[model samples]
Target: MSKPALLVTAADLAPQALALLQDFEIVYAGKTPQPADIVALARRHDPVAIIVRYGQVNAEAMDAAPSLKVISKHGSGIDTIDKVAAAARGIEVKAAVGANAAAVAEQAMALLLACAKSVVKLNDRMHHGHWDKATHKSVELAGRTVGVVGLGAIGRRFARIAAAMEMRVIGFDPFAKDLPDHVRPVDLATLWSEADVISLHCPLTEENRNLLNAQTLSQCKRGVIVVNTGRGGLIDEAALLAALESGQVGMAGLDAFAQEPTPANHPFFGHPQLVLSPHIGGVTSDAYVNMGIAAANNVLAVVGKAVAA
Candidate 1:
């Protein structure tokens, strides 16, 4: 039998994943391709499987490639892929979740601390010779109440760290049947009302999109710090801006944005209390390799008619 053929989107294919391709041929694309473009490309390979990242896999893409059997995501968050489309075509969709839990959790902590210490403000003041240390205010993490949304792998990891810091941890997850001993389960409203800090770790879904809108935010304690290492659409950007303006929310640490590379003139670009990272919550070197390898291995396993963790 000939080697199983594969199509991969713009990502460095790891050697471990490459090794699995020993029995398969591989095709590569630099970035997401349009519907017609993907069809034309698929004609050349007639690949058995296609792997993509945050790219649409609409009916057109599948209809163009009759031989396609599986669609695999390079990381967690299936919000980008059209799972319904894949399923209708009898194509399997698999994601590499928990592959970078540690990386995301660690970055969340880094942002939380930065917000608590007002690190960016202090650093900028010192750079400009303001010597405003006396006016600078910072809070300790130990005695704060941290509300964690979505008690999944990353959320649990973050909660663990918060507990270690002596912070009272509250969690909310509709799917959670049982939670860790350290985290106290609470309703969404209670979490918003009681938490001194709130961290979002949920996925982006229709029911959850803009979950932290104005109404929900109004229930938060004044000066509540917010962090989101999850999805950008989970919070309402416009509402968040208003809250920041009125001091309803003291600070925000964002690793992901509604739009990537956020437009140059965006309001968040120069916001003092806002600490923004380039959606790199899961971009650690270790995470890169692990997720890459797992995605690749999953492709191989799914191609062979099996499931991979």
Candidate 2:
């Protein structure tokens, strides 16, 4: 008998994960897949499962894959998949939770350090043959307070690292449990008013979209540094740009944005105080294999197949 089809919405999958799926025929969606591409592929392949990596999955695509029993995410965030639509069709939606936690947390730390010390700016000056030692001053992290939003695996790990640096770590996440002893849990208001740096690690939901818009930014301490390794929509880019321009925000380090491959003309560019990365917080070599394995397991378990021993 022919094996069932499993569709992956990326150009490639880790060989480690592919090795475990020997029983299934796998199909790959090309890089930069769009919604229509996913729908078309679903209709053409009629896959039994879909591993979402880079596209939106909605009811239309679900209807196209009648045999699809599960939709698995390569990473923790599932905001790209329409959960309501999947539930209506009895399709299970699963995420590889914490699979990339260490990678992303380390990235958040790197960004925070880069911002606080003006590492990027100083490097540019050095390359330009202008010594800035006489005029440059970097913020001290040891005595600062960092407020973390969303105390999940990534958030908690970042908080722990911040505490090690002797920085006060306050966080907010009503759903988080077993938080570290050093992480003080506080309300959003208190975090905004008291934090020297605000870091976002929350998921993107309708209620929390633009959570760091003008109003919230205003509530924050002036010259507060901002770090986001979370969803891009969590911070309003326009507001953040304005704050950065007005000196209300001292610096920003971002690994995510409202748009993927943020356009060349985007307003956030040309600001020395702002540091940007291509949303690669969880793209480490180890995370690739870990997330791939975990995503495969999520797909297998939901399809009533036992994972290999």
Candidate 3:
């Protein structure tokens, strides 16, 4: 007898993860999959489960797969999946929460350091045979304060690292129960006003979308450094641009953007103080395997099965 099909919304999965799903026939959706492409593939495959790695799974795609039982996210964020639609259809939606936390937190740490030290700018000057060792003075991190938004796994990990640097770490997360001793919890207003460096580690929710806008930016201390390894929607790009130009935000290191694979004409491109990456914070090799295993487990559990030992 033929096995039921399982779909992965990426070109590939970890070999270890795939080995555990031997009971099903796995199908792949190419990278950079569009909504229409996902819908078409779902309709044609009628997969029992889907592991979303790199695409948005909307109501249309869910409806296309009649036999779908679970929509499993490859990483922590489930904003790309339509949870309400899945619930209405009696389909389970699961996220591999915290599987990539350490990897992302490491990236955040690097960005914060880069922003504080003007690492990229200095490197550029050196390449052009310019020496500004006497003129350039970078911000010292020790004893400085950093307000971390969202004290989840990733946020907590970052807090630990910041604390190691002898910096004060204050965080804001109403739902976080396991507060570390080093990370003091504070309100949003307090975080904005007091933090020398502000790092965003929150998810994109209707309530927190554009949480860092012109109004909030104005509340922050002058020349506050900003680091975002979280969702792009958490910031209003226009407001940030103005802040950058006005010297309100001294520097910003952003991994995620409002638009993925940002267009060539994006205004953030040419800004020296704004360091941008292609959102590969969680793309480390270790995180890749961990997230894949977690996602596979989520799919199997929702389907009334257990991953092979």
Q: How accurate locally, in lDDT, is each candidate?
A: 0.84, 0.92, 0.93
- For 1-309, candidate 2 gives per-residue lDDT tens digits of 677888899999999999878887899988889999999999998998999889889999999999999999999999999999999999999999999999999999999999999999999889999998899899999989999999998999999999999999999998988888999999999999999999999999999999999999999999999999999999999999999988889899999999987999988888888999999999999999999999998888877453233
User: Would you estimate the TM-scores of all the predictions?
Assistant: 0.93, 0.98, 0.98
lDDT of 1 by residue, 73-170 (tens): 87787776678888998988888889989999999999999999988888887898888756766899898999999988899999999999999999
Q: Per-residue lDDT for 270 in model 3? A: 80
Ranking of predictions according to lDDT: 3, 2, 1
lDDT for 222 in candidate 2 is 94
Q: Where does candidate 3 have its weakest 10-residue lDDT segment?
A: 300-309
Candidate 1: residue 31 Cα off by (Å): 4.9
Model 3 TM-score is 0.98
How far off is residue 304 in model 1, in Å? 2.5
> Could you tell me how far off, in angstroms, the CA of residue 255 lies in candidate 2 after the best superposition?
0.6
Superposed Cα deviation of residue 143, candidate 1 (Å): 1.3
Q: What is the lDDT of candidate 2?
A: 0.92
Question: Where does candidate 3 stray beyond 4 Å?
Answer: 304-309
